[model samples]
Target: MQEEEPRGWRPAVAALPAAAAALVYAWARWCFGGAAPPSPAVAVAGGAVLVLGASAAYALSVRGAGGLFGALFLALGLLSTVAATERTAARAETATCVVREVHAETEASFGEGGAEKTVYRLALDCPGGRPGELKDAPSPLSRGAEVRIAYDPRGRLSAVPAGAARPWKPALSALLLLALAAVLAAHRRRPQP
Candidate 1:
């Protein structure tokens, strides 16, 4: 005999993939945004963990009835990539600004210690006087030096050196979304009981 299902469980179940995807996205952003270690081993480990976590989430959600959880997670990933790519195209302007400050950056060195690697950031005078920072700042950059950078007026993200191409994120995301759509369509065309 089949036991009756509990009340109000499906909604939470449906949200699992979304929550997992969000966590993965945040982790990835942190890794690429220079807070995490920049070593190849660290990057590979992070990528492996993300894949395994997403797979686990899909398995838990799809074991019930519909197999749509995979598509939902994939869609969320694609959306994030698209959003990042959009900033490169819209409201980005090239301008020369005075370097107001220079900051030395490094990964969070916890228990492990041997040597420290350093990166640089240059703060610039933006339109509204709020100031924007440029990551991967050149070694020669110094306060009061004129530097050209690409900045978004809205300041959703930090500035970058001018003439950077951001094509990989959206391209990879589009490919994944297209593949998922094709697979879903094929699955739906099969006959049901």
Candidate 2:
């Protein structure tokens, strides 16, 4: 028997998982980075819903391109949800910080054709009055600026300019989802059982 030719709609269907993952990630980030974050319970519940929906999508799509995308989406959704929950917990323990200094440096990359990049670093005086440097702080921050830092009992996890929303989580999540989609698409192109 001959194998069936691939259909155009398959690619579109496969993309749904990545799109859904992006939306979930964005929602989670927005919730956590907002002035009033949802309770941990709410975050966890949202995570659970995302995971379950992704899983169901995966199950329904098994044995096709959709299956590959669904699996990738499920993994990303799970990771983003967990990160969101952790951020929520950290937000509950946030502290105000003062930017003591803003240091910008241009550095050349060692590999990949030695590209140049500008790095922004901040010196922060956080709660408890201890001073430390914050590497890779968001740009446009200046000396003597006040910022908010989120931390657990052990250490800081994030620093954002005062009244600025944190964008790393959602951005990272979206990037990962896109990468996963690309990988799954490549995998799907390979001969299968």
Candidate 3:
């Protein structure tokens, strides 16, 4: 017997949550500009909504939806956490870094507040002048120019020019993405009936 396609509006349903999330993010970034912090309860509520919506959408569709969602969420969450942490570290202090080299020009993309960010790469020399320091720094810099690089010691390649980013926002966003990916991955690997 031929296997039947699961056609209960799964793809469209699944897309709703993701699309909502994308819209919410875009609104936050464009209108708010990270000027205020969200209340914990509100943040939690929003997260719950996103999770449920996405899950419902996926469940209505095919068996593979879970795995794909998981990976997508995981990647995004991790990125948000890193960005938020970096913003906080750079808020107050200024650390001098020499522009070691500009990494080859690549089209860098990021979501800020919710809108997309277009960025270019610049390799910076750390305080102690460590060689091979061409790790990805988020901000654009000219080769040999000095800049104040603010970053979390625990998160490499998660820094920005001290004055450039809004602390906490990006991090929170990245965390959400990472968490979603993890949860989806977990669910996908489970034994199903």
* Full-model lDDT for every candidate: 0.57, 0.60, 0.51
lDDT score at residue 189, model 3, on the 0-100 scale: 32
Among all candidates shown, the one with the greatest lDDT? 2
Worst 10 residues of 1 by lDDT: 184-193
TM-score of each: 0.45, 0.43, 0.35
The alpha-carbon deviation from the true structure for residue 31 of candidate 1, after best TM-score superposition, in angstroms, is: 25
The predicted structure with the larger TM-score, 1 or 2, is 1
Clashes of 1: 0
What is the Cα-based lDDT of residue 27 in candidate 2?
Answer: 58
* Separate clash counts for every candidate: 0, 0, 16
Between candidates 1 and 3, which one is better according to lDDT?
A: 1
40-127 per-residue lDDT for model 2 (tens digits): 6786687677766765665454446646554766566557644654444333455677888888999889998999988888888887
Error of 2 at 84 (Å): 7.9
- Model 1 segments beyond 4 Å from truth? 1-69, 108-119, 126-131, 135-140, 177-193
Tens-place lDDT per residue, model 1, 4-90, is: 435544555445444555655555555444433346567557766765665555545444223454555455554554345443444
TM-score for candidate 3, residues paired by index? 0.35
